[model samples]
Target: MDLTTYAILLAGALAGGFVSGLSGFGTAVMALGIWLYILPPAIAVPLVLICSVSSQISTLPSMWKVLDFKLAGPFVAGGLVGMPIGALLVARADPQNFKLSVGVMLLVFPTALYFIRKPMAFRFGGRPADAAIGFAGGILGGLAGLSGPLPTLWASIRGWTKDQRRGVFQIFNGSVLGAALILQIASGFVKWDVFWLAMLALPGTLIGARLGMRTYHALNDRNFYDVVLALLFLSGIGLVWSSIAPR
Candidate 1:
């Protein structure tokens, strides 16, 4: 690729990494939209997965203590089941329409969550329900390389504490994206250009993640939630615009 493409990919990686570092999610929501402007979905999806895993692993040392199996286990099980189905769709679907639908849902659901005066105080689902959400997340991951939004929203609705939410976000994203990356590799979607771009993008990812983590540490729960809502809103806008943008 050209210098311009390299610059854009690195810049997108920085933004996406920072967001993932802060919230333990949104790597795809943040990066894929920007990358899509220059790359096809076929290349963009694998690149998103690769960079997302990179951003997520950078936070493990700090986040490992907060992970809760009871919360993440069933969801993971569901996600594992849903991923193959999503991957299959990747080969034979109208990606723009599918993404547009997801984009609309992302906009509507989070907006409603933000407006409610009295947010619920307790976790909202049983293991089965969590698994179902995970499965849906997996399908999205498979189809569009976006797995974080559904789980992130579910965690918000459940009213989890910051640590609880972060733990889920990181663990869930890592698991699903890692699985998708493996599938992508097996399918030969990862090309030399993807590898070289990832290498170039790495330093920016490290810097952005550190900065984001610092910001995350400074925020109170309310402020953190507000940030998440804003990020989700931006993610929705990005998705919608990408879906409708001229090719």
Candidate 2:
């Protein structure tokens, strides 16, 4: 590949890893948004999947104690069913339209959440509701490499404590992203270019994740959330611009 591709991969990896390490998700939101500027969705999606796994693993030790298997189970189960369908759709999807749709979601989802601020709490907290959201997340994960939005929103709506929210987000994303990587491999999407890109990205993922975790420990909950929203809004704008710009 050319220097441009290499530069994009490295830059995306570093930024994505830092965001995900700090927030328990948003690796794809940051990475894929930038990657889509140069790489097609097929390549960009799988690359994010691989790097997401790296980020998750690096930070696993920090959040290990807080994980609640019971709380994360329903979402994991639903994602198992939804991911393959999304992968199939990815294979057939129109590249420009898919990129545009993802860009729109990136822009709209964060903006809506920012404006809604302190949404009415969901009282039920039912397994079924969690599962439904997970299913949506899985489909998005499979299609555009974005599975964290629904779960993140749900966790916020539930008003979970920081540890509680981290537990759910990390576990759910770890499971789904791992599965997505495997599916991509089976579908012949993980080739040499992706492998080399991933290799070059490893250090950035490691370094950024370490820094992010430190930041996560220092920030207050409200401030952390604000930072995440700002990042999402910016990433969304990047994707939108990439979708419309000339190749």
lDDT of 1 by residue, 1-247 (tens): 7888888888888988899989988878888778888887877887888888888889888788887767788777888788878888876877688768878888998899899747666555677889999999998887767888898888887878888888888888889888988988898768888887778777877777778888988988888888898898888898899899888
TM-score of 1: 0.94
Best by TM-score: 1
Name the lDDT value of residue 145 in candidate 1.
73
Give the number of the best model, judged by lDDT: 1
| Alpha-carbon local distance difference test for all models | 0.83, 0.82
lDDT of 2 by residue, 66-143 (tens): 889898999888887888888889878887776677678767877877787774467585889899999999988887
- What clash pairs does model 2 have? none
Q: Which ten residues in a row have the lowest lDDT in candidate 2?
A: 116-125
lDDT of 1: 0.83
Off by over 4 Å in 2: 1-4
